[model samples]
Each structure stands twice: as structure tokens, then as C-alpha cells.
Target: MDKINALGALGALAQESRLDVFRLLVKAGDNGLPAGEIAAHLNVRQNTMSTHLGILTRAGLIRRRREGRVIRYAADFNGMRGLIGFLMRDCCGGVPEIVRPLAEDFSNA
Candidate 1:
């Protein structure tokens, strides 16, 4: 991601509810969860959850799809990868040991 997009993604995650929602969706994987289900899971009102979802969507952190009358939201892994890539660019400085922890984490994931 570019600077603007990275900033937007970071800004979206800076909120408590939004961060919770994003993490929940990531756990949900590709199947995602319906809007109502998400709200219920987070103990948030539907309208309020909708607002959070909107912000995350605009930031490219999550994506939504229509399933008849329902809308399902899922974490956009590509967006996540983009943001991570931007942050990790030139991180290790060709030193493998410097990023070994991160590599181990991804391997488990």
C-alpha cells in the first residue's frame, strides 16, 4: 500500500470497536459473518456496527458482499498484506535474524 492507504488502514484500526471487528473478521476467515451476526458478536448495535464496517471498507481492510438481504463482511487479506508489506519494506536490512520472529509467526498462521 501507498502512504495514503497505509495511513487510512492504520486510522481505521486505531478505534477500539473497529479493531475488534477487524480481528473478529480475520478469525472468521473467508466465510466471514453477516452484519447482524457481527454486531451481535461484538455486542454492538446494528447501526453503529454498520458505521464501523463502512470505515473499514473504505480503508480496504474489509470487504462486504450481498447475500440476498444480508451483507457479509470479511477481512481483506490482500489489503492486510499490502499494509504489512509497506511497513516491512526494508525492515531487516538483509539481516535474516532481525525478522525471524515475524517469519515464525507467519509460519504458524
Candidate 2:
């Protein structure tokens, strides 16, 4: 992602509810969760959750699709990859050892 897009994603995640929402959607994977389900899981009101979802969507951190009358949200994997790539671009000044732990963590995950 470019600097502006990265900043937008970071800013969207800076909020507690939004962060929780994003993490939950990420965990849900491609199948995602419906809007009401997300709000219920987070103990948030539907309107509030909708607002949060809008911010995430605009930030390119999540995507939404309609199924009947329901809207399902999922993490945008490409956007996530772009953000990670942007953050790790330097990679500890090209020292492989500095990023070994992170690589191991990803492998373990």
C-alpha cells in the first residue's frame, strides 16, 4: 500500500471497536460474518457497528457483500498483505536475523 492508504488503514484500526471488528473478521476468514452477527458478537449496537464497518470498508481493510437482506464483511487479504509489505519494507535494514522471529511466528500461526 502507498503511504496514504497505509495511514488510513492504521487510523481505522486505532479505534478499539474497529480493531476488535477487524480482528474478528480476519479470524472469520473468507466466509465472513453478517452485520448483525458482528454487532452481536462485539456487544455493539447495529448502528454503531455499521459506522465502524463503513470506516473499515473505506480504509480498504474489509470488504462487504450482500446476501439476501444481510451484509457480510470479511478482511481484505490483499489489503492486509499490502500493509504488511509496506511496514516490513525496510526489514531491519536488510538484516534477515532481525525479522526471523516474526517469520517464525507467521510459520507457527
Candidate 3:
């Protein structure tokens, strides 16, 4: 993740609904949720949620697949890892201990 890409991903997550959408999709797992279902869960209008989904997609934070007549959205975990890795890349400098808790958290998750 370069600086611009990282900034785009972070910008996508800056909005409340977009953040909720991403987190909800993560919790929904790889199977994901249909567009309408996601909007309903967030108490957002489908059209509005669609806009958020588009921004997330462009940021590479989410992916979509056509499922019959509807589109299902899922969290792009690799993209997420890339973003985190980018942020943490320099954090390990002279301190493995600082990164230990993060590894442990992922392991627990």
C-alpha cells in the first residue's frame, strides 16, 4: 500500500456508514451480504448504501460478486492486511514487543 492508496483506504473508512458497512461485512464473513440486506442492517437507504459500497470498492476495502439478481458484498481481507501491514511496517523498528500484542490479537481472533 503506497501513501496515496493507504490514504484512499483510510478516507473510505472515515465516514460513519462506510465504516459500519466494512465492519458489518467483516462480521458477515466471506459469504457476505446482499446490497439490500446490508442497507437494511445499517438503517440506510439502498441507494445511499450503494454509494458507500462504491467508495469502499474503489478503495479496495470491499469486493462484490453477482449473486443471481442481486450483488453480494464482502470485506477484502487481503486489502485490509495490506493496509495494516503498511501502517505497521515501520513500527517494528527496534521493538518486537510492540508488535507482539497485535500478532496475539490476530491469533486470538
**lDDT for each candidate structure:** 0.95, 0.94, 0.94
If both were scored by lDDT, which would come out higher, candidate 1 or candidate 2? 1
lDDT of 3 by residue, 21-69 (tens): 9999999989999999999999999889999999999999999999789
What TM-score quantifies how close candidate 1 is to the native fold? 0.92
- Cα lDDT of model 3 overall? 0.94
Compared with the true structure, what per-residue lDDT tens digits does model 1 show for residues 9-86?
999999999999999999999999999999999999999999999999999999999999999999999999999889
RMSD of 2: 1.4
Candidate 3 — which residues are off by over 4 angstroms? 106-109
Total backbone collisions for each predicted model = 0, 0, 0
Predictions: Cα RMSD each:
1.5, 1.4, 1.5
Candidate 3, run of 10 with poorest lDDT: 87-96
- Full ranking by lDDT: 1, 3, 2
- Model 2 residue pairs with clashes: none
